[model samples]
Target: MGKDFRAIFWKDIRMLVSGKFFLLAMGALALYTLYVNFGYVRLVELSMYKVCLWDPQGICVDGSLLLQRASSREELDRMLLEDPDGVGIDLSRGKAEFLLYRSTPQVERYLEDYARSLLRPQEDFKAEVLGAFTTEEKQRREITCELLFFELSAVGFLGIAAVLFREKGMGVLRVHACLPVRGRLFLLSKLAVFLLSDLCFAILLTLLNVGVGPGLAILPDVLVETVILSLFMALIGLCCALFLQDFRQFTMIYLVIAVFVATPVFLSANTSVKAGWILFHPFYHLYMGMKNAFFGTPGESFFYYAGAAVGIGLLYMLTAAAFSREMRDAPGGLRYAGKDVEKREEG
Candidate 1:
């Protein structure tokens, strides 16, 4: 059994290598690393909010750097009108008042808190610096980690499925069914290949984008999370490929996964917006796990691992079942011979 599995594994590896899957993945890794290091990290570091202040009687401190002083109330009102989300401060009545165009009430409250915090002097605050990582380093790691997670979970998952479905369509899976080996070995081989690819991608991505010292420090936890997510996504892709008739159907389903499933989890995790049900979403936990790994906070409860184990097991079982069904259904139906058979065959 072990020998057969090794043979199957080697065969899969050969196929993957010949098909240039690794080469393509290498290209993607390079492109993503460049984008994360040069593009995404820079974009995230630029703070978006503009603070416009209107203070009459020169009551406000002149040296305050946070406030962008407006000449008059009319000017402040105009600035606020132009950028409704821009924070506004009015000091017309000898005391400062915060003004904002109300969009989401939650966001309005958040802006108020932010405005107040900005107005305070640095000497008044005694916040601890948790790590020596600079803002740029932190941003690099955060976005690099996110990009790696996305590449493995979604892009790599789809790539593996596309390759597998091509073989399935070519009736190659049926040939595997007749071989003197466990079908599970065949499935395992593909998973092993993709998992290794994803892990290597993660390593390179972290090193290139997050710099060597900090990236190496967090490598173990990052790899742990990468393995977990890669296995889960590979199984999912396998399950989908085994069940779906063709790439067209898989593409449709993948679209749903990309938009409705992954987008909200990303938004809620990275942004101020919080969704109540994200606690139950598996990807949300994985996303947080990756994020935490980047920040050197890998601690999570036992339930996280337990849930991941359960999910991976369930997906593997489903994929196996689907593979069996596909094997049974390959030569689905037959018909009698005639001109009718010829016409029917043409149709």
Candidate 2:
């Protein structure tokens, strides 16, 4: 069993190489690392909310360096007009008055608090230190988590499917049925290869973007989530490749999953867009599981792990069934090849 599995694993690796899957993965890694290091980190460092102060009386003393001084109330209005998200403070009324386009009550309150905090820079307001991550470290972990989730969910999903489709075209799966190996072993080999590839990716991505120490601290939890998500996506890709008539059909399914399924999860998780239905979405939990792991707060719920285990088990069974069907429906030439092997053995 071990020997057969090893052979199949090596064969799958070669097939992936021929398809240039690893090259594409490496390219994605490079792109993500560059964006995180050069683009995202710097961009996030730009002030979250630009505070424009229009205090002509100079009543405010020792204000935060973050404040953008406005010569006149009109200039403050113009600044807010240019950047609608910017917070504007008008002290023309002798008392500080907050002015901005109205947003949600929660957001308005947050902006007001932030602006008020800036006014009293000299006050020593001691706040409890919850986590050790600095602003830059937190941003790095955030973008890294997002990129890793995308890599596993979308890129890894496509890689396995593409490899499987190539094998289907080459009639490799047909020969598997004729060989003296369990049908599950072929699927297992593919899963093993892709799983390891994804885990390595997670490690590198985390280490590169989140720093060596912080990334290492969270790697164990991150890897656990990666394993579950990797296996889940790989099995889904395998089932799709096996059951779909052709790559064109698979492309349509891929688009549907990428657009409808994954997009909603991302929006609901990352953006202010909240959907009541997102809680029921399985991928959302998977995404959050990964995000939480990056933050070093793995979900402690037994049900989450249990459900993931069940889902993976069910997917594996489904993939195994699909593989058996594909092998049974092999082309006549492959059937002939199998017969020749049997005849040679009998002789």
Candidate 3:
């Protein structure tokens, strides 16, 4: 049994490598690293929102460096008209008034606080550092965590499905049914291959983006959560491969998942956006777990680990059922009649 499993495992690895899976993985690693260091981090560092002030009477005393000084009220109005996204303050009357193209409650709160931060009593306000990480470290951890999640949940999942669907289309999976190997070995082999690939991707992503010292400190927790997510996603991909008839159908479903399902989770977890029901979304917590792990703030909840185990178990069972069904139905269908000729001849 061990030998058969090993043979099947290596075969899948060879197939994956031959298909340039490793090359794609390396390309993704390099691209993601460049994006994090050269693109995302720079954007985060330069997020100081532009503000225009029209305080002709000198009513405002806020010393916020983010505030842009206007020589005259006319100049401020002209600037605000030119840049709609810029926050504008008008002090025409004795009382100060805020002006902008639009305002959300969140944006209003930010503007009001920012205005207050520039006031003379700066001691009354305090800017707290949320974590031990500096600005650069925070940026590194946030982008690295998000990229790791995307690679494992979406990209890595699709890669495995693409590979399996190739075998399925070529009728190779049906041939495995007749070999003296355990049926589950095929499913297990794919899972193992994808799990290893995902873990390697996570490590490289963390190290390249977060710096080796910090990444190593949190790698164990990150890898634990990664393995759980990877296994679950791999099984899902396998299930999709077995059940979905074509790549086009699978691509549609993948699109829905990567967009609607994953987008809300990212919004709720990373940004200030809050949804009351987000706690029910499994990936939300998983994403939080990863973010926390990246910042060396791993969640100690037993429910997280337990839920992951249960999720992985259920997904594996579903994939196994689908796999077995595929094998069973393959030999009896007209589509498989030509391929089953050898099976009948052997019988």
Best by TM-score: 1
Per residue, candidate 2 scores C-alpha lDDT tens digits across 243-277 of: 88778898999999999999999998887777899
Once superposed on the true structure, which residue ranges of model 3 sit more than 4 Å away at CA?
Answer: 42-45, 51-66, 79-97, 100-103, 267-277, 331-347
Cα lDDT for residue 338, candidate 2: 71
Please report, in order, the local distance difference test score of every candidate based on alpha carbons: 0.82, 0.87, 0.82
Q: After superposition on all CA atoms, what RMSD does each candidate show versus the true structure? A: 4.2, 5.4, 4.4
Number of residue pairs clashing in candidate 3, backbone atoms closer than 3 angstroms, sequence gap of 3 or more or interchain: 4
Backbone clashes, each candidate? 0, 0, 4
Candidate 3 root-mean-square deviation in Å:
4.4
Better of 2 and 3 by TM-score: 2
Candidate 2 at 30: error in angstroms?
A: 2.8
Worst 10 residues of 2 by lDDT: 121-130
**TM-score of candidate 2 against the unseen true structure:** 0.84
The residue pairs that clash in candidate 1, if any, are none
TM-score against truth, every candidate: 0.87, 0.84, 0.83
